[model samples]
Target: MSFSLTTDARETFIFAAKNVFRDYETTPPAPEPITGNTWDNVTGNEVKEAALALIRDGKDPAKDKSIQELLLRWQLSQSGIFPVLAAENENQTLINEFNAAVKGLEALTPAAEEDAQILANAASRLTIPNLGDSYSGSPRDAMLHAGARVADARLSKYAEAAGTLLYLRGIQVQGEHMTPNWFALAPLTFKDAHRHSLRSAGTASPWTLAHARINIEPAANIEEIQERINAYTTGKRAIERQVEAALPQWQNLPRDAYQDAITRAVNGETMRDARGGIVTWAN
Candidate 1:
């Protein structure tokens, strides 16, 4: 079966595309003021307020539309631990500090505005792919799936290590169980994500491509997704080695987590359905 991403899902795909291309944009000498709707035009202080409100009084999607939308964009943007994780070499102390800072209410707000702007800039530079096209088990579709796996692997490794995954989970309110979507450019409405590869065959920088290759080596060949995943023993083993490697020494600062699910999914023990939901295999 094939599926085309919904509007929200397409935005999420674009988010991943931006994630890989955020560094290449040109901006004004002075940061331009953010412009948009009432929900969209909120300031840094307001974002912090919304964050607190989200933690203190979880916004209902219906009643608290404004703050909820703001919070959604912030979290969905490159805020919190994302910038750190998305850094070239993931850091340890930064991970430790981010795990610590999120507990307090003040430190994260200033960065929130900047990160949202970064996403804005990326969106301008990004040539959004044909997300409207249907995705089946084609090579392009596989590239998209493998890209999401790379995303999950990258996230699960560090986020799980720093204890931030479940820590963030504990803060969920209104019974909304957050998934990889909440963190990465992973799509929410659709059960999966789109990342750098889907944006363009050759647009991702060598660094980003190298990062993906380190975890899933065969993934370097976007066409490899067409083969049975189980046959990619080298890719699976590459992921294992990456999983077991020692943390890189502390970098100056940046960010901070997911793994088994991806390995199993990659090895064909589990898989995502057409809509991006998880589908387990009993055999």
Candidate 2:
């Protein structure tokens, strides 16, 4: 059946679709998978024995402190709270001591990297059957697939809205699907519309023309349309008011402080507190 939409509806749908695209593009990428063999070997009886031996050896207090710090840093790294880049130099002393201890332990067995790889391979081979079968793949893979499905569903809604808007504009639209799946649109004549009509009289009508092919480009120009809409809605006076509201006490600051504050604000390192006081740093 043929259908149509009003101009306001078309604009609103286009605006919403653009927002969806913007959000999708700005979403953060997934985190990297965990790595390294220390996590796997740290719990072994041999590792515990070696750690105890080091403690009982009556090592210098400074050496013992470095060993303790190294262990703490290793545990923190395993938990994903990696050492800060700026603190690397400060950690070098502890890292050297940790490496010495690790080297001593390695002399009695395979290298830590090699041992970790062996353990990883062994775990992979011990996979359970029928686990996550309902998802058609591993749990992590299934989760990614589900996310893609949701994105596709959202895009489909935008496509439908675009098609409706085009139909209202008297464009011939063809195809049942839209972008990220398939593109369908073709020109149509009155006779073609009539032939595909659902009307009881089987005659050509304005409603049948709603099935006309529509170009996808207009809907894709959402950014340009949004800019135009914003320009119309946000007048110069409104912008001035917003600026005044955002920095109400800008005129009261000393000249030097004002320039510094402006620089910090531009760099996103400063902001106004609840009481309109300037906060120069973040915790």
Candidate 3:
């Protein structure tokens, strides 16, 4: 076990004591654990004692990271102390192992180069993917359908107002004079109709018009939108499932290579955290 202070040792000692336990003030809450964490179980009072012990030994409590850290461990820690973390950390551990493997290949037969190359490739493959084409938020078909409904509603209202105006007064509303609205409106109407199976307006309810076409000169016939909403959603879901299904295979990748190196740098040893607990993942 190797433990070294991240910063100056005295400074580390100084900061570990400040406001670790105070009266009527909000203290930092305990942390939620994630990968590569070391845990401890000790009571709040016991933690306070650990801090006081630092002061007893002529050390500063406010600066002792371990004291505040132990406080976070907070009654759950039953582990031993002086968890000596190594001078070298886990990330460097892997790099050192990789370098050792590459070097060993040089000392071996011709086939050794190929094996080392595989190790290099595997190391590089460990990363998060951007996954561009798999964005599931587009919902193109659904959006098109929604847009159509809004457009139809607005058009219907306008037509109704025009009809009311013609009925009440002597103004003319030549919808044909509005033309096919062709340059844009007709095609938009067809898209909306195909996606949503919308009924034709102006032709009245239970619309008799077979397609989204108006009685205009040029036709507006296009295929209906696909039933499966969005291509992106399906594509993204398939990718997510594929990656999830490979979970077990992903667990030991570089670690296997790390162990296979000719020189096992950290073999038969336990890695320790700053608080003297075992670095679980490092092992």
Candidate 4:
């Protein structure tokens, strides 16, 4: 069956898409204003006040080299401007200190490497084959598609493992019987006669006469059984690869997408059998 999203589900997808876009566009807060004492225990405010004092004294603060350096350093710290330092130690000034603080703050900022791709994918409105036409052209379809795809892939793996366990006991036949012997029947006999005679023959047959019953009990050690199942499913390295590929998209999903995926998984709505057929759970 094709995947289709309901009206509410579509709205959820749009909301998540908008969030992804907003996160991408949102600028990180400017590095917290560097706070510390300047040269000789002078604070940023003190440096600013001293520069103002020079101006009040009918002197150019810019012409006073010491005052100029302090004022420049104070300005750099407050303006969020990273100062570049010269190679000579003799010229080492507040600019070097400010630059160091800036570098330190930069190191603390987390990289936004995944932002662009996440935003583009959320906005692309891409479609997946399973979701079908119902989700086409919908806002944030790309993220929905990604979530559904990953959920389906996980379900398929689970179904395969479960189906294997189901088949381990072998197929059960309700009634074993042989085909009608057309040659042995009278030439004018009707088809009904042939069938009746075959039934009689089957009944008299030794193989059919015997009744065999084989009762299989659940594993004595449930924990061991669970461990084995986990070994068969979660322990597979390939499953990890699938998880890694889908995780970024999954992480970017909105709450609705997360809920939808979990609901489908628990309800077996996303499971596929060994033959790649959908497996619906009983209500």
Against the true structure, whose TM-score is highest? 2
Candidate 4 lDDT for residue 75 = 67
| lDDT, model 4 | 0.34
Highest lDDT: which candidate?
2
The candidate with the higher lDDT, 2 or 4, is: 2
- Give the higher-TM-score candidate: 1 or 3: 1
TM-score of each: 0.19, 0.21, 0.16, 0.16
TM-score, predicted candidate 1 vs. hidden true structure = 0.19
Candidate 2's residue-wise lDDT over 35-117, tens digit each?
A: 34223213234444556777678754346765565566556555654335324433443333333322232231222223223
List the RMSD of every prediction in angstroms. 25.0, 28.0, 34.9, 27.9
Displacement of residue 221 (Cα, Å) in model 1 is 38
lDDT of 4 by residue, 30-132 (tens): 3233334223333587777887898999988778998877866666655543322222221233333323322332222222222222323433444232333
Weakest 10 consecutive residues of candidate 4 by summed lDDT? 206-215
Query: Any runs in candidate 1 off by more than 4 Å, and if so which?
Result: 1-100, 128-181, 184-187, 191-283
Which TM-score value belongs to model 3?
0.16
The whole-model lDDT of each prediction reads 0.33, 0.36, 0.31, 0.34
